[model samples]
Target chain A: MNLIGISINHRTSSLELREALHLNRDEIVSLIPLLKEQIFSEGVVISTCNRTEILGFPQTEGLDVNSIIGSLLQAKPIDGIKPEYFTRFFSCGAVKHLFSVASGIDSMVIGDSQILGQVKEAFEISEDLDFAGSISRRIFDTAIKVGKRAIKETTIGEGAVTVSYASVQVVEKIFANLEKKSALVIGAGESGELAAIHLRDKGVGKITISNRTIERAEKLAEKVHGEIVPFQFLKEHLHNFDIIISATSSNELIIHADEIKTAMKKRKGTPVVLMDIAVPRDIDPDVRKIDNVFYHDMDSLKIIVDQNMQKRKEQIPLVEKIVMEELVGFFNWYNTLDVVPTIKSIRSFFEEIRLDELEKIKNKVSDEDFTKIEDMTRRMVGRLLHNPTVKLRGFAESGANIKEVLTNTLILKELFNLEDFPTNGKSDAEENHNSEGNDEKN
Target chain B: MSQTITTLNVLLPLLYLTSFTVYLYDFFKEQKAVGNVNRIILFITIIVHVSYLLALTVEYDHPPITTKFEIFSIIACSIAFSYFILELLTDIRGTGAFIILFSVVFQVISSIFIGPNYKVPEVLRNRLLGLHVISALLGYSGIIISAVYGVLFWLLYRNLKENKFGLIFNRLPSLEILEKLSYYAAVIGFILLTLAIVIGIIWLPKAFPDFSYFDPKLTGTLFVWLVYGVGITSKWIANLYGKKFIIFSLIGFIVAIASLIVTNSLARTFHSFY
Candidate 1:
């Protein structure tokens, strides 16, 4: 029950320290087993670019954090590594932190979404290494579910929160299917190349890169696997493109209103997206006035980025609510694990007494009477045990303090005068008896 | 049966109101829990509405197309049913809230004023007349749908032009899709209206004996059909589209609505069989 973890994330330590202390796949593969051998019954290591966390369910309460840190440092040592750099969390806190990390809310970029897959990989690695305890497996399973539910049910991962991505979002908003569309990049500078890459990634069918210099344009076109169009024919080819992204160093507008108007005439009311994500503006702002031409300059894209970021921020509480719901579900199952054995024992105790009494009366009654007696005694035991069993399970699943549940379970055991059992929820006598019964049946 | 019709008349509008509210909730909140159930509510509402129409038909001994109020209820059901089909075909449910709101208004008006019209002409009970009226009602539903998409297209176009980047821009279908739907719906409306007019022409003389070609219903139907016909032809022949085509569709819808009101309520016409 002693779930614990330490996180060295972007918020806790410097980038240099994190890089130096980060564990790769091999290090994690070795470290999890080492942690299991030294202090923990189960362990997992989540190592991503933004964070490296080592979580475990310790076998004893007297474990040393310094020894755990030393084990990690041994795998990938760094100078001046200290315990203060790692933020520690106990049972509930560790669970919540893992859930948030999986949900992508705790990443350096809010809603990065890639962290969920990484979390899954981390869990799978631990599972494959046989470092997974029953409790740890449940925890990791719930974390993955929480991550998926957050994405499916909320807008946390929606919209574009960066400038380069905002241009793509604008185009998506204007066009229903990008696979049938074409894009023309007017400049081959960094921003223009980035925009073209985003467009290509978004499945814009054909990307044609046009630039003032042929070599730079050819390089970008090659990178995006696109065609290269001469810069001089940009306006003439505009009519063929569904999207025109212009980013350049030109102080004046590279595209004029008349050129766009001519393009619109040829497009026959088919809409076009004109993205000008460059400083000092590249496409004419007057293009906005033309019908069926959707235009967004750098300032507008920034506005969209801001709005999307704000929208993501608003979804924080919703994602947190999902995490808490899943966390409660996990704890409910965890707490019930304790009460399950007790419930089984109570049923077994009453059944043994009922069967013993039935045997004593077996010779004194007719066959029909004996069958009736057996049925009556069985019903009596079931009726007598139903309420207590139901209440005990309700208490366990109520998500109250585990200590309270354990105390109630202990009291029930004492009141019943049941034989002492192991904390693993099974006794040696029960195991021996069940095996003998199975052998006889075989 | 009359009691059942009365009860349904009261329940029909409430059901539509509930469906509209669910759709509106999904539109603004965009919550998965609500969005997933939006169509279920619409489906249930459509079923209940069809049942209501059946009850009216049983009670009155004719299809629920004898009076303007009954026809209004029929139109309400038609719009909801058509939108459901469109949603299924295109997998576009984002505009359901706006589309279902029209059904709510029409159903509410019909539910408030609907009653048995026992004096309906014998000609109204003819199955041909029923088909003609039902086709005309469905045609009007298409016009309304086209107009709705046109207005949405205009709103989104303005938002993109002015760089609003607000909720409407984010939620509405793209301009091209809206325009395409609008144009498509207009085509459907023109074809259905043409069927209604042809049926009317076939049955008019047999029923009226002295029926005039200048009957307000006939002339009104011709006018609405001509408007949509011209709009569709312009698109095919002159490649007319976008804002110009949307404007044309809206104008056609307005004329259709105006003509309906005039021919039904203002002018003297044998079309009002009751």
Candidate 2:
């Protein structure tokens, strides 16, 4: 309940201010220690191209927004970034924001997967700096899990959003085990280079680049860890590649249907994917009529990308539901942290009465009988306190209004006169039953 | 034993229906939790179907291939069993409901009208003859499954080509994998059909002196076998694959079902033994 977060994300600031406010690794390392020294008991600094957030538990009664910014400025001074540019979140707001950010719902490119990795790396940095406590670790770990669950339970991250990536995705739909497949990117233009890079990132076994100028082809091939083939020999070598992407400026068709037909003959009916990303259309569209050839021009790839983007947009509600579920689970654990101490106090109050009463009957019976009476009274007190203890913990971890739970805790403390009872001795009843109570909550 | 067989005969269709329902739900709704439940239900149904067939064989004193309806039930069980194995091996569950629906229909027809033939001929009760019929039924089951996958492949291929992006396109596996599975099923069918034909060629003449090689059932089966043989051979040599190969496999399946219908209902053949 003592959490607070300071964020200068894309939503709250201009690109110029965000750039100035962004903290690198060395900057975050220096700033975290200062923030810990001045204000936070525990904290994590998440800095990425889109956002830089500092989430922490405040050490004192008053949280000064300026002091936190001052600490940041001390670590890495910015020219004109003002305190008004940073948005602040408190308590449940902070927790919800963290979950949404990790789940990619709050991303600039909604469902940008890199944000989840950035969140995890921030947590690791906090842990490495000994700034992450148990509570901080649990919250961050829960955020990571929420991110994963969102991806697994919804289609938010499915398909390709970029044109070059869409070309690779089309090939993937027709082929499995990309590591066993080969690729050929013709022309070595910017689009062709991007296509080759995407294919290489997908672990395609071999990539061959062909261009009119050998110098550009060699440069791109080396960058993608691929081989270069002379542009004139592309027709003869088409059968060796399972995927072919053409992106060139030529107005004339660089790849013809007859050449592809010849390749399919020697390839023995194996499937081939051809992506023509050029503005003027490099590969012949008629190649799609071949038996095992799947051909896609830029228009088709754009349609696929647009459809995928729409699908991701439709999945926002599902991802938000996942974030809500994880937030509730996190609050259950967070609320239990408050309830455990109160539970211990209530048990101590009851044990005090039971032991005091047992002493009154200590001398009225034989030693064996006294032992039996003591055992019976202990069981009686345990059974009497069991339901209330469980109910109290349940009310706390139920993720209801925090004020309501706190009021109930106050009423229990006042009703039992638990404040007068010392919280040290004869509290064995709680430890025995607390695990069962917590297990039921979980 | 007859009582157990009767109970199982009634229960088998219901189990197949349940498996198909759950699988259909999983395919449409994409519920992973329910998908697991569907597989377990399917596994139990297959086990129960096997038990039913065993009980029927024990009670009737021969394999459950004596009548056309009985063979329908056997083919139903074989299809379900083969599809279950394919689902397990490939980890592809989208096509399971479509495949299992065939089992549900066949088993329902079997449960409604099929009964034990007490007057089956002694020659039909031979173990070698039982093997031949069972193998033939299994081969037909494989062909049926291959045909189903081929249909799915064609549907998905059309969806992709037209850029429809509908539920069928989203749910079905990739075109390449579907084509591979269809080809694999065809190969399995061709092998099993060859075994059945070889067994029949060795045993049929010695058992029946008047057995005619030109019997309607014999010629029909030979035609079905030769169609698949040619299809498989063309795939290897002539590079007939992809959508073309799938179309060919589907034609072979249609020819097979036509042969079954003609030999059973239209023609007077030597296979009628009851």
Candidate 3:
């Protein structure tokens, strides 16, 4: 599978450029239908504040991924937007990049667990659009595991000083007239609690702390006098809150910036100061440049400690370690996955041969003898396949693309008919037949 | 209660300073081993600080926040403790070490004139007075820490702006997080300061009979209060902060500390629980 990643990450780029390039959820929905027009196998959209990446499983006869991006954005010109915004494509590189990004290895702050959820949500949206399939599912799930591993293995962000507090200042910097307003802290952790505490002391009349774990957020809510509210109820109760500081550490950018903008738009542009303290940051930074949608980071809690510059310095080594290890680990595992379908196809063909031969001789054999023959056939196939499976798995685990090696080895030419299986991952003929039969019932 | 008193003018503050030295060493050295050592040493110092407070509490038969000397020392102690918690939570190692060092120095300086509040009659003890005293002192601790962060932010901003230093900036998260943290901390400080000042003003007529008007402590506190007020207003209203705001924060710390010293020297305040 060919993977093309188009992203605008923590690089310096204007919002206008990003907007011209970015695909809103609705736009992505429209584009998903468009992808049915392309030969790409599967697709997912990840629009974070720092970056907007589209990971596509392209056909082997790969065309420009930009057409997908352009078609999504409707061919709008992004002014002076550097090539830096867009990253490289991959035969299987997107999986590794995604694993690292979701794992917090690629995050500004290492050990931030929120990116996993943001990634999952993007996949979810893709799934809703009927685009995300096995690869998306496996890759996104692995991303979560990688994130959990970062937290478990390192103290990259041990103190969990979320930068949600900084988002408040972003608002303060923008409006400079916050005395009349209140802020809602949507989730409590290092970021939400800190934001609420800041707002409370800002003499804000209201400071509400809502969290998936409302009980956990109670102390902060009571301390800040924002009141305790459940996370489930937020959608309905959101109208009452003005500034929503969401730091739930959810995988998705839970509060879509557009949701806030729309909510505020209906209410005389009530400034919804959304500070994301969960890394990959809670706030979609894109929302900040949006009209009246003040946003902030899920950066480190350096703000509360006040010695952040020094602290960030201290965290460098740990972050580097996390990023490096994840990079290596991801490359290995991704390469292994790349070789999987070939292995599966090879195994399928052998099984198909064995089944056909058995069926051909069934009438000539006794039932008991047939069972024995089947077991012997399976053992023989396994013995023959053991070396390649073992070697390929080892290569894939270390971020080596075994499929490339297999291609060079001409294993495809020797053992199988490449056209029948289709390198672009066309559904196996049997699956197509089965699905077609199922469809006939409908 | 008076039985524990020996009138030993003090060598303890010096010892705390020594402890601060250890914490400083731990903070700047960039070693986890050093942090472990510092945590141990700071833990001991915390014990010492708590003991000092407890001993005084027994001698005076109240919380240690009963005298200017005790208040200053306790505030320093509280700051150290709170900072440790923050460090442990954030796992941001060296920053807490420096803060502890600063706390140690502040405590040492304030300890020389560590004015202890004498016993008060039952009539002087009220809920508001207690809240006023504790919150005010806590506010002092928070502000002191905030000022430290302000200094860090200023240093960071300067380094980035002038290219004089980037090590600290590079090591640090984005300047935005530091500035945001400073703002949040100052806000919390303001809440406590406001609470403290409000109660101080309300009780003046009853607490000090001859003082129907405002006193030096009142004025000094008002000045700090104004600084916090401006800080808060500017954040919410204009979202502006820079060297000026940092300077204001530093000034707030200086003024608040000075007035606290002056007030303690002048009278044994019911609110003097450092």
Candidate 4:
């Protein structure tokens, strides 16, 4: 079996190209059968917002990369993009890439945890379509294990790697508990919505959303289970909130230093965290210097995000070590698969020769002598074949190079004149047939 | 029995020291596995502590409250017991290091100062008095823990207000949780202290006809009770909370500690049996 992968990620492609090539759940499901027929025996398609990877095990060697890419592009065609934009990996590299991707190291946001779930969903889809067989199953399962291990054993997935999540983390650092804290989200934009959602997820007791338009604020509030506040009342009620996240599209500053100072005066020294996660910032920068007012703009949040990213990057070697260990385990088990059929073929070839010799000698002797002779020959065959069988198993268990084992297997087969042996070795069937023939003959 | 008590005396302190170290390690390292290990160590320490107290009771042929050393041992056990229950209920292991360190200190002090064969006074031999003393010790344990929580809350609140996002900020529970914990512990302390004082008052004349109502320990007890009473009542009725309540609880505990020390040192009260 030959594992193969083709990927187009944030590092290799532009956002437009990635979007053009992106596959949804339905698209991925439709592509599964085509991928199997056009490229490999088993296939899995992992398509997330940041990356799209088609990983499979080819049924045969010398499969054309261009042809596989052509098939994929044909299934989901994008204009003006060549197959060269996608990066390809062969067997070991393919497996390692999948493991790394599942572990979130290859994600756009290095330690974002969403990629693991995406990978699982992709694998489940492949499983539902019967496109993933035992090898794919083992690979996906091992990838998931590596993902969980990377999260559990190391700090790769520890901190928030996004600005929105970092804002919530800042609140967590300041307040230590969000259960009793209230948050106000200004401007109903994506970043503001994300911040509010994160605060809600962290169990912040109350959340209010305010936008220039009350309808938009109400919509976002409904989504985050927060109450809608009119934009005019935002500054007036700022003292009531412990955390304030502002992400508006307005060019001018929405919250000025004077208003914040007034709010602080009313807060009676209770600290308030203000996160301005917007371009051209929604809050005045001078407000950060105010006492009892913890103000962080996008740059400050970016510093936290960058620090978290750096921390996760430092854990790459550790995660890579874990992945390498898991790879060795998988390869060892896979090497055993390559040797098992060869071992069986050798055993059956010897068994057939012994049975043919026994048949020739059966009628040449008296009944009692024939019985004793047959028993003796059977014991001799067993003893003679035992050492080579044990040695072959030892070679397999020792995790020797698969190519060397296959070469040795070929030499053994040639030396035994077993060239006519079945390519798909039906060893179990032959063993059963031999035993039944022996019983009838006796 | 005496040999077993001796063995327990050494074993319990060593166990408590190990628990203290584990909790400290967990506090700094912040690993889930280390936290789990700390929990198990603390649990084992508590079990051994209870066993030691049982061995002491067996050796003395009564509850082990006859000597200052025995009372200290009970105090140490009560602190650990209350902390263990809090940990179980809150699943907050960050405060374990501080609480367990205090327990170790108390156990060490008890072991060093309270000898194995101290004499019991005639006035303290009454079972009711023993109950009162044990109840008061447990109550003091509750108050002490509440005071620690109060201190942590103030430290956290101050750090947040100052934007000092340091170790204490990350490790301790949130301000609201700490405040609630302090309030709960203070309530428990208050109820137990009430029980101790009431029992003391009802049995005061029966035990000692010459016992004065104005004795230092009794008067000190009443004063601490009134302080905690005012604190709790203010929190409930007058919306006194946050830093105000935290400061009140800490002051109340400090007064209680002062009462204990002054009454013991001055020997102007019959309650100072040691």
- Which candidate's TM-score is highest? 2
lDDT of 1 by residue, A186-220 (tens): 88988888898999899999999999899999999
Candidate 4 vs. truth: CA RMSD?
A: 6.1
Task: State the lDDT of candidate 4 residue by residue for A1-442, as single tens digits.
Answer: 4788899999888999888889999998888888777677888988877888888877778888877778778788888777778899988999999999988888887767889889999999999998977767878899999999989898889877889998888787667567788899998888888898899899999999999988989999998889988998777898899999999998999999999899877876667889999998889988877765778877777766777788789889988999999998777656656555555566668778878988998888899998898788777777776777666655755676777878877788778766666536444323432333232222
CA lDDT scores, all candidates in order: 0.86, 0.86, 0.63, 0.82
Give lDDT: candidate 1, residue B31.
76
Ordered by TM-score, highest first, the candidates read 2, 4, 1, 3
Report the poorest 10 consecutive residues by lDDT, candidate 1 chain A: A433-442
**Consecutive 10-residue window with the lowest summed lDDT within model 3 chain A:** A433-442
Q: Residue-wise lDDT of candidate 1 within B1-274, one digit each (tens)?
A: 7887788888888888988888887778777777558888889989989998887787778898877788889999999998998888887777888889999999999988877776677888899998998898889899999999999989988888888898787788877788888898889888899999999999989999987999888898899899899999999898886788999999999999899889978999877776
C-alpha DockQ of every model: 0.50, 0.37, 0.03, 0.17
lDDT score of residue A436 within candidate 1: 30
**TM-score per candidate, in order?**
0.81, 0.82, 0.40, 0.81
Report how far off residue B191 is in candidate 1 (Å).
0.8
Give per-model CA RMSD: 5.9, 5.5, 17.2, 6.1
Fnat score for model 3 = 0.00
Which model is ahead, 1 or 4, in terms of DockQ? Answer: 1
Better of 2 and 4 by lDDT: 2
Candidate 4 residue runs with Cα over 4 Å from true position: A6-45, A57-88, A123-133, A152-155, A170-183, A200-207, A225-227, A235-243, A251-307, A314-318, A343-398, A401-404, A407-442, B60-68
- Candidate 3 residues lying further than 4 Å off, grouped into runs, are A19-23, A60-62, A75-100, A103-114, A155-194, A197-306, A313-317, A337-392, A395-442, B1-274
Q: Write the per-residue lDDT of candidate 3 for residues B123-211, one digit (tens) a residue.
A: 44566676787788678777877787788876755543332322464344434455555666678788988888778778766766676
Clashes of each: 0, 0, 45, 0
